[model samples]
Target: MKITFTLDTIDKAAEEILSQCQYKTLLFYGEMGAGKTTLIKSLTKALGITQTTGSPTFGIVNIYEGNGETIHHFDMYRLKKEEEAFDIGFEEYLTSPYWNFIEWPEKVSSLLPTNTTKINLKILDHTTRLCTIDNGSNELK
Candidate 1:
């Protein structure tokens, strides 16, 4: 689905994404400075995650604990090899109940589930972002 929103309305759109998204795990695809981190931070706040959420580019994955299912914010922007993720049991996280938000998912397409929701982000301006989420449909190809 594709939609347009004002720059300041990112949080609102994020909430809508959380509510309407069929899959708990979302893969964010975009180039550098595409607002992937911003989208995910908004999603975490919508989920009531109070802790500071930053890019997991260096640490690989950042985990946030919640009363219900936890949130796994993963950034593969700095990933040099897929084996680094594999060594950290990334596969286990994929199958877990916690909601996962992955940035730079193109780096691990082979490991991602077929049902994984793919979000494509494009920077329309410094404040505006155009996003489209693919629901694992052949139409995406």
Candidate 2:
């Protein structure tokens, strides 16, 4: 599903994304300042996460608890190579039942599951942004 929303309506947009996304593993794609973390904050809130959400840019991954489940949020931007993922046990996380939210997934593209959900964000203006959420099949339904 695709949505165009402003900051004021971001909560609603987050709800729409949750309704459309079918996978627990999600890949977020966008350029810097495109609101990837902003949208994720809304999404985690929708999932019942109560703590303050922050980007995992430095730590690589941050774990959040919500709805009696664990969410693994990853930022692979700083990794010099895909092998760094394995150094950090990326495979173990991928095989777990918890929700996985990956930013800059292209950095570990070779290791991503085929069924992952892909969310693309585009900055249209200072206040408006467009999002397209699709299953990794390359078909947006």
Best by lDDT: 2
Lowest summed lDDT across 10 adjacent residues in model 1 is found at: 132-141
**What does candidate 2's lDDT look like per residue over 22-139, in tens digits?**
8889899999999999988988998899988899999999999967978899999999999999987999999999989999998998888888889999999999999988886523
Best by TM-score: 2
Candidate 1 deviant stretches above 4 angstroms: 137-140
Model 1 over residues 34-97: C-alpha lDDT tens digits?
8889888888988988888898888889998765659988998777877778977899999998
- Model 1 per-residue lDDT at 115: 71
Q: Relative to the unseen true structure, what is the C-alpha lDDT of residue 33 in candidate 2, on a scale of 0 to 100?
A: 93
Model 2 RMSD in angstroms: 1.8
